[model samples]
Target: MKKRVLDVGNCGPDHSSIKRFLAKHFDCEVLQADGADDALAALRGGHIDLVLVNRKLDMDYSDGVEVIRQIKAAADVAHAPTMLITNYDEHHEAAMKIGALRGFGKLDLAKPATVEQLQPILGSAD
Candidate 1:
């Protein structure tokens, strides 16, 4: 069966790029969530295996860190790997503290190097 991934980000160019990249590399289904609430709902619904959360989401309800915390607190997805994607360096430490598996700067993700960096993580998750 194909692996499943929840990609929480604004529906835009950046999110499209990341979703396309993952779809190309693995037999996976990508589900888009506009913000923290939607992401948490998706996780609780067992629709995804991992979560790729954008640092900035559409809603003002909460940020990615809080989303990660919610996921970690939930029994269903507590062990799910949460990866935070951002353009800022300052959020990295905070994301890790909230239970994110890793942080990928959008700058790095824009480069071809992103594939190399993501390979091992995706492979293991699969």
Candidate 2:
């Protein structure tokens, strides 16, 4: 089965970029969610190997970390690994403090380090 990645709260361009990058380099499916509700529904609906939540939701300008917190609070979906997508170190640290794994920024989507970080979760395209 292909790995599944749930991407939450990114804007159109960033979502496209992320989908493109993941499609090019990993044999996984990328699912989209616009907010915490949508994300939680998607998480409970199926198996998601990893979750990448934008630092700030474009849909309503809400805190993405709060979404992560909600996911962590839910017992059924909390087992899924999550990451915060942001360029700021402070934001990354903040997310990590709340049970998120290391995440990559939109700016670093194609970087070597980002690829390395994703490899373990999504593996490589076959």
* Residue-level lDDT tens digits of model 2 in 7-50: 99999898999999998888889999999999999998988999
Q: TM-score of the candidate numbered 2? A: 0.96
Q: Candidate 1 regions off by >4 Å?
A: 110-112, 124-126
Pairs that collide, model 1: none
- Which residue pairs in candidate 2 collide? none
TM-scores for every candidate against the unseen true structure: 0.81, 0.96
Compare the candidates by TM-score and give the number of the best one.
2
lDDT of predicted model 1: 0.74
What's the C-alpha lDDT at position 124 in model 1? 33
